[model samples]
Target: MQDLPFDIASLHAAYESGTKPGDVVAECYRRIAASGDPGIFITLIDAEKAHAEAARLGPFDRVAKPLWGVPFAIKDNIDAVDEQTTAGCPAFAYEAAADAFTVAKLRAAGAILIGKTNLDQFATGLVGVRSPYPIPKNALDPEIVPGGSSSGSAVAVARGLVSFALGTDTAGSGRVPAALNNIVGLKPTVGALSASGLVPACRTVDTISVFALTVEDAYRAFQSAAGHDPADAFSKAVTTPDLGTAPPHPTIGVPDTASLEFFGDAVQAASYAAALDTLRSEGGEIVEFDFTPFYRVAEMLYGGVWVAERHAVVGPLMDTAPEAVHPVIRRIVGAATKFSATDTFNSLYRMEALRRTCEAAMAGIDLLCVPTIPTFFTVADLEADPIGPNTKLGTYTNFVNLLGLCGIAVPTGTRSDGRPASVTLLARAGQDSLTAALASRLHRKARVTLGATGWALPEIPEPAPTLGPDEIVVAAVGAHMSGLPLNGELIRLGGRFIATASSAPGYRLYRLTGGPPFRPGLMRDATGGAIDLELWALPLASFGAFMAGIPAPLGIGTVTLADGGTVNGFICESAGLEGATDITEFGGWRAYLAAATDRQGAVP
Candidate 1:
């Protein structure tokens, strides 16, 4: 076995350079045994079977199978053929006849299954210690409780035992562990990945999540497993947006000072402040919003009727094997029996009202940045007051799924006390790509190593300007460009920045006659100079609506790029150029704005 970086990009590079999959598998087992953590896996796949599967993958072919030859682990609650499907309760364990919908998709994509990882028994607890199995040690520090119920899956990825792993998230089961272990955890939108075979905790809120050493690797796994599943009634055909580039001057919402909670952990609080500063340095505008409504929504997840949904799945088990269930989990889920049908309806109504309030608070905010876990607790702390500490740990996470949001937890940096400092970027459903794009940039900027592996972060390649079949590329020469006053309109319409380029040499730029928020128009001229422009992709379905909003004299027309490519862009009629200022000498709207600002400041 050779020492290898297990990130998707690094491992694929080694595969391209002649490292065989069999060798990688051998290394995986070697690391697992050497890890000295006995609770990471509940059942290991037969080494012979895994090697045979790898051998069958043939030569490296990332195009045909994006996850070809990649090794991964699955939370035990999710079924895999021939493996015992245990929701961490041995009595509830049963042999699976077929793989879960998501599992089968990964298998088809050539990801090798390594084992079934441990989790909170029946996936009921945020603390990993609820399992009948030995607790998985925190990959970063042994004293701290390994965050759960996706504890084992996250620890495996953080410790470099697997390239990635599948974890289930209901109330931050997926993301909390990643934050604790110093890795990436992507909780995609609900129904984005099928939940057909997953042992239900809270069926309505549960989502299959990805844990990886890097944001890029997690997103790759997500893309492979994401799609509609006819077998799952909750599954929808959600399209994963293309993560083109980091949005310029993103408006990030943070908890207002009055609502921020750190649970007395000053180090973590300071770390979060630094993380916000990092975002500010990256051209992000920090907007502090009153988080009271969001906090109320979080309380509702475990405080109200949602807990009854958990009982719907495991009520039979609780009745039959009362003693078999962990005491803490039994207490939590058993409380659901006290709620009346009327209580459920009332709670649902309240939830809808809270959702509206949250939406209003989130309006105009591109992403919400929050401490992944408000504070960290140790095993000793859990033993002292299990429920209280666990509830506090979820202070920032419980409201996400309830609000139908997507989020990714990424490591910011190590705290002053040598603990992991992390923040989760969240957005409304279907904005997974936007959150990921920003998370990836922040993670790289932090310069954190890949989990506990000590491998330097891999260079993120610039995504190419490739449009999905349902998308149309448009070039923005002025206000619609990123960081400009009118850029919000394009973003609201699902437009993503692709790249910055120059128009063909035959084009000239003119500053249209307008006050306040000025607009620029491009036109073709034989002696015109190339003008800088920004390329963006908009959904084909929204193209007509976007074009209809264009005012007279400026309309969508084909414009040639310096790269010899043509795209729909803003073009002005000859009559409209009558009083328009020719700003072609400034090359771009941004340059012209900068010069104007400088000249104003130079006044007496």
Candidate 2:
């Protein structure tokens, strides 16, 4: 077999060391030819054209460009100038005059565009076989469906054809295929990536997604491709931080086991159970919650008003040339003609009610965990019941975009039957980094090789963990340190230890007039104040719980640390200082205790 574990970073390193880009381009073609999988690509870029593009880069320049010399493929639904985009429908093929917004971004970042890969016709199906084009066989097992419409893109990455590929997801096009192929798929928030120049799926909810072997590579590709585009009306110039690791003990919301639907695939059901065990092994807490509201929201996609959006895009073409669309696609899109405007409005109202229920259901969680797909299906199964199994596969995926959440699919392990098993971590918009962090750890825990490739897992430097946006750092001056009674509140809420440091010099501590548990108040003074404090990272999910436990004048607020970093710490309001006796001479809480012990000269 041709090399199964190729990545962009490695290729760039080889190019910088002296290998020619043309040589690597030749290797890509050689691999494509050797794979004997004609279903992988709808239209490949001519080898000669690829070499010409590779030759333009004089030398590898990682500083000026990140993806320099990297090779990648785009789903045919996305346009690439000079390449014909069939979108899995040869009769509807068109030669793109210019690259899609995502393609233009990748080219600017110095990534080589290999070609357009196959997909379900019009980006309509979750099963890979929905197209007239040959179905890209599952990378792990040829017996199973490839999982579409990002089917080819996922398989190419899994087979080491490219380091990463772009796939558009309206429902689960980006995630489903990644799960099927045993790779990482990052579906960013709707407006996170610019969708200009791409064919519309559900125009309002469409996003270009990333498929790569590792979470780091996927994130790197996302950062390069994502940014506000003035050309795209849907694009937003929102602030986004680079991906970071999550603090230990993340609050992961899990669907109630009874709510999970595996459709009688016992192997898949067992795989999911093992995945939850894997999460527990990593120090994550799984909070069980009802998933009915989410399921109701998902139903709206096929049964509600959104199906009309597909009709809106292809309805005209269907009217003009119904024969051109695939028979199944034709039947589905034609159903839109039956719904009147009144039906659309009724769906809109029902969806709003469902959304509220979902919001309440998701009240206090940092991330939601779900099987990437409910189960696996084979090409024969698809042939037997094309629509049924396809819908079942999307049980956990269909409602994500409708609820406005970001998700990343990461392979966890292989089932006993040898098929891949995966899980997706979800977060609210702007929490992409949190999901990436948790997903990467889960990927490593699976201990699986990269997709179908035999490549050993690369040694990735562990990312420094940080608190999420909702989290606030707290300073504990008294008994609330690690391993203490009060510390349990913080730990239960997904808090992690950050650093052990002292406060700035201008602080005074006083033993408050309290009993049973004992309490202390910290006051700021220009002349004298010395209080020792330990910093603990607190996630937003449990910040309120910690705050409510505080008694009297001591409250949570920002405090400057010895390193000049500010975090939410203990602060005393002015009124509490009246009856308190000053103990400013001691530099810290530990020092004050030391003095008291020395003065008494015996253990109490």
Candidate 3:
């Protein structure tokens, strides 16, 4: 039992084999004791207490509780009823009166709390060593610094102490640690998880994050925890797409050569390059874009009023007991005093502009992929220069939340120096599933062991999330495809990408004569070819509005997939083909467009 892998799939296998949940809980405690890492937990739940929680989970019903009897931890900053949330500042510790919104949801899903993990003081630093308590030693290498401020949570997952754990991300708290520790870190869209019970660290952008051994596990934990909370002003209701395979040919945006930053780590740079190759091998079209605007947004995190947001949470403590706060945190948060309300407003305006600029760079790109951490930092390196290395660690991560983007950090491969290679897949807010889907593919491609455990990565199937009563699935054939011109119309109506598929044979595609944005029309014919198309789920309420916008010659009709499954999609009237040119040999509109551009030397 001690040797059983802590991954959800493996653990559930043990459960199906009649292994008692209580014994599994006991084994988690045993693993904790054997880990020799006291710094990992700020508050360890009693073994018997945890067992009681597991015991309460009645007979196996994964349907009622997807996380049944699964053991996990939360960062010390998040509230769990009766537990103290210290935010890594001992003087600021207080017992939580209630479970956080996410906590209650996870518990309701049958996940048992193992303990509360350590973090940087006031959640102010990225290096994970700012706590008054002992810093968690990096699970991969003791000489390296554990990433923070979600340090212990990441370390705990990396060490296989738990199946998954909750952390928080404002800058790179959730993701950087996952990279350093070689695990999957899911930094959800801000407000996707409520902030009501969390100790604030830039409250406006802070999100409860999840760390797990695999993308599927992290996503499952996220699904269990995420819900709209009316109590949290920042919370927004966003739809989470089902976990399916990524688009068949996604346009992946990467940093241009001049904008790529590795901080002199050749191995890290090479690892990132290799990861891009893996993405390409997996059928992604890599598009290089200017990453400079993103860097400008990152600078605003600590350079402006965002620091003031962190200070807002700890200002009173700093005023009353300056000596009680960690010196590093005091220095970081204290600097917030320099900004006036005017400075705050100006910074806000600047951030908006930078966000827009960065968004432009992401135009026509399905997703962006970047190295999770620019380079590695050692414990000794932090001791020599505490703030510099932490700042460098945020080089790729700080801009994400500021720009309202969601990302997941997944281990790609091992660097030449034996350190982990990780890259984060980022997409616009509410698109967490798309990033996770690609990250999962990338992780599987690497074939690396899970964290420091050496357990083989589990082979898991796509989780088929049951669609809600208010939802409807639609197939998109041309401009409505993701990253295409008219795709935003679908998104504005809450359309979420599901998967890419090919239309059933005998449906010929043609470039219908039209104006402004050229559109494609699919017509049933005797010798038509299978054309590429994307499946998207939209709200049933908005389906009428989408349907109302369909122009002449293009109307929604039942289109059969190559697999024989049918979906409602754009179909053309036979009369609409009068002036159309058949492009069936191109297979898809995107292919035909590419050929047209190559021949005509301009976009169609």
Candidate 4:
């Protein structure tokens, strides 16, 4: 019991193997006491009450209650029933009669409430020090600023005091802290998780985020919490897609050299370069794109109308008790008064133009990878220049929500100076699962220990091929397999890679004759051996268009997999096999292509 890890997988295994939820709850308090960081939590639930709630959870029942017995903390901004909600402003505190929409959802899923954590006042600053409460120490190093306003939530998870903690991200509150504290931060798509009961920083973009020791835990918590809530007008009916196997080769976009900024930190720049190398090794093709338009969009988040949105939430308080608000926050949000209705419209117009430019910049890319924070800032640096450091900390984060993108920050490695190195994966809204799937793989590839807990990442098995009910499974033997030239056609048709599998015994694979970008033909064979192929899920509505695109010998037909299950897949007419090269013995198209490349290289 003493050696148990708090990651969701390990904790659930412990529960199944005879550890009780009461004991887990007790251990959470023990870890919190050992941490010696009172700043990490604003208001903790009584130990007896937390244990009582755990007891009510009964046994481990993951299917019915996914977060059964999981201990989680909430940022002070998000409400939990009977808790005082404070957006890091003690003067603005109020007793919440009910839980935030997402919080209630997690609680209903069998998660035990631990406490309300600290944050920047009104969730205004990226620096954790903007709070009225004592600042949370950077979990890794005391001198460094714990990234905020989700600072305490990230620290609580990093210190292993909780399995996961909820935070809000309008402009990187969720991610900056995770990167600085060496944890996983998942800023889900806007409105994917209900914002009802959360203190508004920028109501339109605010979202509840998750911090955990592992990507799997964070994603699992997300699965439990995400759904549509009619009570929350901002909520969307977005589905948390199954995270299947990573695409064999993904095209990832990186900021061009000229547009990349590290605030003169060369070590951080080199670390980012190494992180990109790791992605390349994981079968990612790195494309450097001009980030000028994106950076301009980022600037608009703080430079324009968005600040007014923040002011709208706290303006009356600012006027009543200006001194009660953090001085820095007051100054930042106060600037909102400088803009007029005309200015607001002008900024919106500019934002729309920039959004178009940024979208164009990302047209062909599957994911955008960027440094979670361009540079690290120390407490002393913030003390020296509070505004500049906080603004700079948002370098890669501020624009994400503004552009309607989803992002996750993952720890990549440690710098030579022992600081954490991290990269964020960004994609269009509702592509949360795609970025998370890749981030999970990348996190495992980095081999970094979990947060500051010294717990090694648990071994993550390759995801099994799966599909949602609304999708149709399609198997591809050659051209449409991941990394193949024609694979984009499948992607354009909304296909998600499921797995690489072998066809049921008695299938023949051949390289079709006569084409620059040749195709493959799969046919039934009475005495044939198994041939390798890939399975993907296409939306039911898009299946027709996909079938229409097939030409000549290739057409959709029922194909059997090694597991004795059948799915719609590609097959060929017997006539198309004329002059074709028998490639069944190569196992798969990738293997055949590799051998061909080797043979061609040997020619000289």
Candidate 5:
């Protein structure tokens, strides 16, 4: 039992063969001891308590409890009933009154809590060493700095001390650690998971992220943990779609040559080039775009009004016990005081302009792919120049939440010098399933072992069909897609998303002239290019009411899928072409709509 890998599938296999939950729980502690990394945890649940919880799980019924008997940990900033919520500041520590919303959800799914991991003070740093405690060693290479503020969480999962752990991402805290530690980091849509029990760093953009050995494990944890919490004003019911196949020939956007930054690491640059080649080989159409807007947005995260949000949470602590805060964190969060209320509004205005520019840059791209961290930083290097190295670490990650994007950072392969290499796939919020599916394919292609465990990558089964027997398949290519404005209508009508499917080579996508919620016009044309669309299973009973809501220039028509299958979907009449802008270059309505989120509206 101690020799068994703790991946959900392998653990479940052992359980089926009569392995006991308490034994698995005990083995986790044994491995933690074997690891000899005190920096990995801030507080651990008692071994006896863990065993008791494992024993209380009773029968191994994975159907009712998907995470049954699985061991996991959370960042100290996150609350667990009776555990101390330190937020990495000893002076600010207090006992948690209840389990965090996500913790409760995971516990409900039958996962056993093992401990609270260490992190950057108040989740403030990208380099994890800001903690009052000892910094976690990078799981892959001890010489490298463990990425932060989720350092301990990432290392714990990387070293296989636990199957998965939860970390918080405000400005790259979640992803930077995974890239450094050779693990999968899932930064979910900001509102997808409830934030009721999480200590705020930058409340507007903060999200609790997952660190796991594989994309499958990470996404599975996401499904069990995601839910709409009415108590949390920021929470939203973002759909957790099945990890269906990625669209063939996806239009992937990458940083243009002028925008590529490696800080003089030729090996990192070469590895990224190799990864791009792999994507091309996998049938993705690589399009290069200016990354200047994104880089500016990343700059805004730390250098803009958002810093004031961090100040809001820790100001009182700083006033009462300034010495308790990490010096690096205090300096960074303290800068917020220089700005006035008017300065904040000024930054917000500038932010809107930047967002519009970025949205326009991403107008036609399916998803953006970038190096998880531009280059590596050694512990010695960070110690020599704390601020420079930490600022450099957020090169690719700091812009995500401010832009309302969902991202997953997955290990691609090893670099030339044997350091871990990773890339993050990002899309508009609520499009997590698409990124995960693509990430899964990319991970499988890399053939990398799971974290520091060196356990071979396991096969992830294809997702089951989304349609029910009584449901009729209806295709959507416009705002009706997930996370878009019209998606609510589908949910109200019992529409279940099946998968994102590509159309045959005879369709043209257009942005139809419309109101605040702009709509798309997908039309079949002999000379048109292939486009992407969503498949939804609508009840046969509700089909009539759904069709009745269709306006002029749009009506139900037979749409041809890349697989040669046909389904009822939206089609624009030729008359609609009079005022519509051709958006076929963007490939799909969702891509077109991504820019529409800007205040100036859809700038195709």
Candidate 6:
């Protein structure tokens, strides 16, 4: 088997161990050229320019600069300074002055830009073939359509041409391509990656997504690229949730059998079932839910208001020179002109109601797993019924962004009939880290090799441990510390152990005057105060619920940790500690718990 060290970690290791970035760039070009796949990149960067950029990057230093020496590609629709922004439309090409906010972030993090890859014309269609330029052949099967607008980006990473690539996902463009090519596609929460330099493909719904051979690579790319961009109106300011590891026995949801649309592909259905079984064996609880409302939300995209947004994006371009656009793309974007402003308003009204319905159904599910696409179709099939089969390909995907959710697609297993089968895990917006964690586990569980190159599966990289929405680190100095009786408060809220440490060397712990839970009041002091505590991960939603039940003097607030990470923790107003007993004698929370237990003659 061919050696497959295509993930960012391995590439980083090689770089650190003295492999030159220029050499890797050369190797990448060699492999991409040898692959004989002309459809992958619409504009390949000059080798001399790429190698010069690589040479300029001094050395690997993940701390000072993550993504160091990691080579990546961007979808043509995303602006990369000096690269042609063809967007798969040769007639509409132009040179960009600066990198898109998304690309600029990656470049700042030490990623090298390889070039621009092809996409559906103006990112208008789900089918890869809806491009004036050549369609990227499916990495897994040449006869099949490499699913759309982000098609070439997906193929580029899947073929190991680059460690990762940037793709835009509006209505599954990012995810469908990943599914079709058997790679990881991370469609982060909208506004997570700034869209400043991206050509609008329905500006409201557009997001720059990442494609990589491993979940960890894709996730790391997301972390480095995701941040608030003041210049981009759609950018939102939100902390990156901790992309931590999954806990044992995770709860995953799947659409009920009646709601699953396999489009008569028994092989694909069976593959998904097997994938679920694999997840089960790995200690996941699969919950079945009615997905009708979710599908209804998806219908609102093209059938309701979103098409108008699409039309809004490219209508002017179409009117000026209709011949420049691909026929399928022209038809889809042209149809948007038929809807009136009132129709759009009605669609918006109906969509808000549908979003509520979908959220209600998803309220308790940890993660929802669905077939990335209902079925696979060939180029001939797409040629015969361009829109119908293409729409079917988005059966499990189209509704995600429309309903304000985030997702990551991972290849699961090949269908019995030999086509690739992939699954996407969806969660509410801002739950991106959770989905990535689950996708990482699923990728390892699948144990599939790299797409088409027949390269052996690289060692699954460890995702960086960080806090997630499902967890909030809290510093507790009192009875609520781990293993203490009152610790049940955290446990009941699905909290877990993180670490034991002291507050920033300037806090005092005081035993509250009274109470059954016997909470400790922790406060910052001017001098001679050092309080010990342990940090525990509490689910965000449950943390709010837990906080609501707090009594007077005790509240949730930021605590500066020894390691410099901020965590919500126990805090008390100065007044609440007036008559309290100082308990700084105990070195740490565990010792305090031990002392308390010894005093009671109980094993803690």
Best by TM-score: 3
Name the regions of candidate 2 deviating beyond 4 angstroms.
Answer: 1-4, 464-570, 574-604
Clash pairs, candidate 3, are none
Please give each candidate's TM-score. 0.94, 0.83, 0.95, 0.92, 0.84, 0.81
lDDT of 2 by residue, 486-577 (tens): 54455445555554677776777876665434456777777754456777766666677778888768898777777777777887887887
Residues 42-135 of candidate 4 have per-residue lDDT tens digits of 9999998899899898657999998999999999999988889989988889999998988888999999999999999898889899998999
lDDT tens digits, residue span 1-604, model 6: 0253667778877876878888888888887888787888888889998898887777578886788888899999989888889877777788999989888889888888887898888887677888766678888888989888898999998888888999999889989988888888999999999999898888888888999988888988999999999999989864465466654445677999889889898888899999899889876778888999888877777777688777776777788988887788888777787788899888888888988888778654566889898888889998899899878877887888888788999988677777777899987677686678778788888778766656655675454455665556787777676434466566556565455677777777777787665667877776635667776777777877888877879888888777766778888888898788777677554566568788988633
Per-candidate Cα lDDT values, in order, are 0.89, 0.80, 0.90, 0.88, 0.88, 0.80
- TM-score of predicted structure 2: 0.83
Model 4 backbone overlap count: 0
Tens-digit lDDT track of model 3 for 1-604: 9789999999898899999889888988999999999999999998888999998999987889999989999999999898888988888989999999999999999999999999998788888999999889999999999999999999999999999999999999999999999999999999999988999999888999999999999999999998899999999887775577665567789999999999899999999999999988887889998899999999999988999998889999999999999988889999999999999889889888887898888877778999999999999999999899999999999999999999999999999989999999998888887789889989999999999999999988765534556788898999888767677677667676777789888889999997657899998887888999988888898999999998998999999999998989999998998888999999999899889999999867
Model 1: runs farther than 4 Å from truth? 241-243, 484-486, 505-518, 523-529, 551-553, 573-585, 592-604
Give the per-residue Cα lDDT of candidate 3 at 402: 92
Candidate order by decreasing TM-score: 3, 1, 4, 5, 2, 6
Model 5 residue pairs with clashes: none
- Cα RMSD for predicted model 2: 6.8
Using lDDT as the measure, what is the rank order of every candidate, best first?
Answer: 3, 1, 4, 5, 2, 6
Model 6 error, position 160 (Å): 1.0
Error of 2 at 62 (Å): 1.9
Off by over 4 Å in 3: 463-466, 482-493, 499-506, 514-518, 526-532, 544-551, 561-565, 585-604
Write down the worst ten-residue block by lDDT for model 2: 482-491
User: Which candidate comes out best when scored by lDDT?
Assistant: 3
lDDT of 5 by residue, 493-587 (tens): 65665777899999999888875477888888898988989888777888999999989899999999999989999998989888788989878
TM-score of 5: 0.84
Better of 4 and 6 by lDDT: 4
